[model samples]
Target: MAQFYSAKRRVTTRQIITVTVNDLDPFGQGVARHNGKALFIAGALPGEQAEVTVTEDKRNFAQAVVKRRLSDSSERVAPRCRHFGVCGGCQQQHASVELQQQAKSRALARMMGTRDAPREVDEIIADNPWGYRRRARLSLNFHLKSQTLQMGFRKASDKELVNIHQCPVLAPQLEALLEPLRQCLSELKAVRRLGHVELVLADSGPLMVLRHLSPLENGDRQKLEQFSQTTGVALFLAPDSETLEAPGNVAPWYHSDGLRLSFSPRDFIQVNDAVNQQMVARAIDWLDIQPTDRVLDLFCGMGNFTLPLAKRAASVVGVEGVAALVAKGEYNARHNSLKNVTFFHENLEEDVTRHPWAALGFDKILLDPARAGAPGVMQHVINLAPQRVVYVSCNPTTLARDSEALLSAGYQIRRLAMLDMFPHTGHLESMALFERI
Candidate 1:
């Protein structure tokens, strides 16, 4: 039995009520209004009637879990993964693909509001339904009393860990190595000191980075080497903040397009390679850059888009806050012989209106910002009114907020599409094309 961390409160069981789900909340939970108060129920699809047991009651709304389905929606499908409810990794595995896409479109539309919403929504880009995840961070916990290693995602609404034997979303190689890894860890004395395991599947093979709090003994090192030899997965050790070392002949993971991009186990890279390829192609296609066009690529990391855009544009300026990434981007540009691209390291969050580039006219602009969105960059965008702007966002709410700002700045949304970069989840990747009115 798993031990769950719970908040202190009085436990009261309310009467089981049958409610018809009317819509979905932002997190994809089915929403139903009961007696003028909103009820957010998990495992209940929109348009379906279900008996729910209220788990949490709040001032404005209540949360419940489906006790029994009275009427099922056609959109509800049998979830493929057995760990769907226990693991917090996937939220919409029970929803049909069509229904999931519709829900995402509706969510995006609601965020953008009716005035400046996309006139037509494109079909959500779906990839492999299973075994598509190429990167994952699995939390590690050792129960000394049970003498067992616990590895997997955290439980929903709780801090308890779910010891998953096999994950449907992980690549087959990584999935097959899970049990062996657990067994290996069980034998190691340093298992108690292990905090987490970061798994990265490159084009070549899978690599395991063990995050440990203490140094491993020689016997533990031998065990790791034996496991790596048997499983053919490279083993890396992150013993402390300053040290990261690989035991055997493990090469660095390099993701390449026109130029090779190298990063340590810690650097950020899109997990899904196939979808990332499509996303990059889509962003470039939407930009519709010309040879004479001058472009500005904001929040550029290692020249993912900057180098590609440099191939078409007259000159592309890439700005990134991290000096290391900016240096890497410059090296990649030079390695690819992309002479038209220039990298600048600056804090984009600060005002750049007084910068020299603020006066340098740019015909096209492309922004791929983090989840916080690009409010600071938006001001610069308003100052430097580019003829065409392509915005790629991982968060819908921030995208909507920035879209509203751009709309007020006399930019009309020309095209918008959602890419299902992450499947079986509520996360959305959206791209919008804005042209100056």
Candidate 2:
């Protein structure tokens, strides 16, 4: 057994200590107590003995990094990616996929105040834990010293970019483009001007968006086109545009559940395709739509759920904050020949309860808000008097905070489960069904 030391032993900065991890933080860092205060260590797993060197000391807690693992947790496993520990993109890769899912569920339950409150994980919607990411935004760093380009995700604990030759988490097709991209860019006369790259596996095929700080020379442009042709991946250029949509003809889309959702490359879409299908099916099933029921979908980006929900309900209305996404949603509804769906552009965070759609009153409502959450929009939902509300959350903290408002408004949580939308990462996406008490 590794020796343990109590924090009362005159803790000091830069001190080395051995501690057994008790739990994991939401970010997947190990948590332990010392001298009646909590300490966090990265790369440490619960039930493992971590030899750590303290990096930061505060009145209540400390932050440390594991210098060595004296004993490993049974649930821990080898991460598949070479960049697992260094890349900030993934945190829970060191743990088994099963353990990762369980931890996420526990975190969600605790955050929602339903910990040990008797709600079972009716179904854990998940898919392949590796090679599932279809979209990735890579950092571009040109190393003049080596006269080479470094493209990858940022480092785990800092903004420094980690050069990656290959990534296992990205879709195989997208993953194949990394080396080719680096090689082709190295041949360019103006490689140093490159800023960032966004890769998306569009319905048509793989699409790569090359962001450059300045205009590309004709020779460099030809090289990019050659690279795209060689890889069979569509190449789009971004002139330092933040939205990342280069003016061109590619309208990327994805088909699922008898609907085709089209959106800009920069728009938000669920990463795990297999799990996303399951999530959509589960959401619709939980809503229990009736032919006469009116359904309202908030934050409807490109009609991911609205189109499918429209197929079953008498009428479905989708409201989105982004006008571009609203337009895309309308186009998707029209393209899919789905007649019962109507999309409106509205900022749900604002005082839009008076929106015309609210006057119609919905039988059920679905909310798929961003990490910032719906932001006190339950009042509007209550006023609409929807018999049921299904919330799909990407962040538990925000969901938990909003649950308070929902509970106060007389809503009862009927079902809750965590969706492993992002496996091998600490990111948790949850779905909950609430019925009026």
How many clashing pairs does model 2 include? Answer: 0
- Model 2 misses residue 129 by how many Å? 0.5
Q: What value of lDDT does candidate 2 attain over all alpha carbons?
A: 0.85
Backbone clashes under 3 angstroms, per model: 0, 0
Residue-level lDDT tens digits of model 2 in 179-249: 87888887888778888888999777898888888888888888888887878777788886764543346
Candidate 2 stretches with Cα past 4 Å from truth are 1-12, 114-121, 242-248
Over 8-34, each residue of candidate 1 has an lDDT whose tens digit, in order, gives 754666768889999876466999998
Q: Number of the top candidate by lDDT?
A: 2
Assess the local accuracy of residue 68 in candidate 2 as a C-alpha lDDT between 0 and 100: 91
In candidate 1, what residue range of length 10 has the lowest lDDT sum? 117-126
- lDDT values for all models: 0.83, 0.85
lDDT of 2 at 102: 78
